[model samples]
Target: MRFYRQFRAYLVRRKVWEVTAYLFFGILTTLVNVLIFSVAFRLLELPWPTSNSLSWLVSVIFAFFTNKLWVFHSGASGTRSTLWTLLKFMLVRILSYGLDMLTMWLIIDAMHGNELIAKLITQVLVVAVNYIFSKLFVFADSNSG
Candidate 1:
């Protein structure tokens, strides 16, 4: 029990806790994206692009709230501040979404590769990039400025 408490305390250290929380939320976000995309693309016969966009929308919304509240602990300060933060988050995500679309297009459309495989690859890339952006830009401490 003592060792377990120490381990828990170690995990709760700032960077460690942030990363662990981000990873947990990130995985949930990925699952949300993949499930929506799979259902739309494979089950409903939607085009890959449309399905991907829809999935991105849902997952981004999920990610923003989870990332803000749990991962970074960047709780809303005021309406304007929260809106600004959300705007920045969306802009960064749009950049990553472009990357996602381009990679997916190249793999599934141009290279004639598997859509699901391409999506999985894209998720890994997107998640890494999003973490960087969110940590450095979107959710950085407001008082740091």
Candidate 2:
């Protein structure tokens, strides 16, 4: 309980703008992911998993740059630090991508391939998971300024 309070206070002191900027980055990536996935699947006749994986790959490429500059602001003092940070970034993304795949599977299989609904459902679930993981794990550093 006290930890949660301290965390909230830390966020507030850092300025809500930081949080807003991070959210905006996530929203942009999610929009692109869903747009590409839906368009490719519905109009271009791509398979569900194929479209989902491709869209996620595209979003991840964009996310790497955006998060480095905006979300984490990792000074990354040297090439080694940069590489280390990117390793952590990629690790976080591995889990995020896995969640995305699993969510799509549930939507497609368990929910019966109602694509319109499945796309929307999986997008929401994956975006929330990505945001929480990115903020709490990927971009978390005491000196991430």
| Strongest candidate by TM-score | 1
Query: lDDT tens string, model 2, 69-140?
Result: 876676665888777877877787878778777877887877677765776776677667766776676666
Checking candidate 2 for backbone clashes, the offending pairs are: none
Best candidate, lDDT-wise?
1
Pairs of residues at least 3 apart in sequence or in different chains that clash in candidate 1: none
lDDT of 1 at 84: 93
Error (Å) of candidate 2 at residue 49 is 0.3
Residue-wise C-alpha lDDT for candidate 1, range 1-145, written one tens digit per residue: 9996676578875438677778889999999999999999999999999999999999999999998887888855899989999999999999999999999999999999999999999999999999999999999873310
Q: Which stretches of candidate 1 lie above 4 Å from their native place?
A: 1-8, 142-145
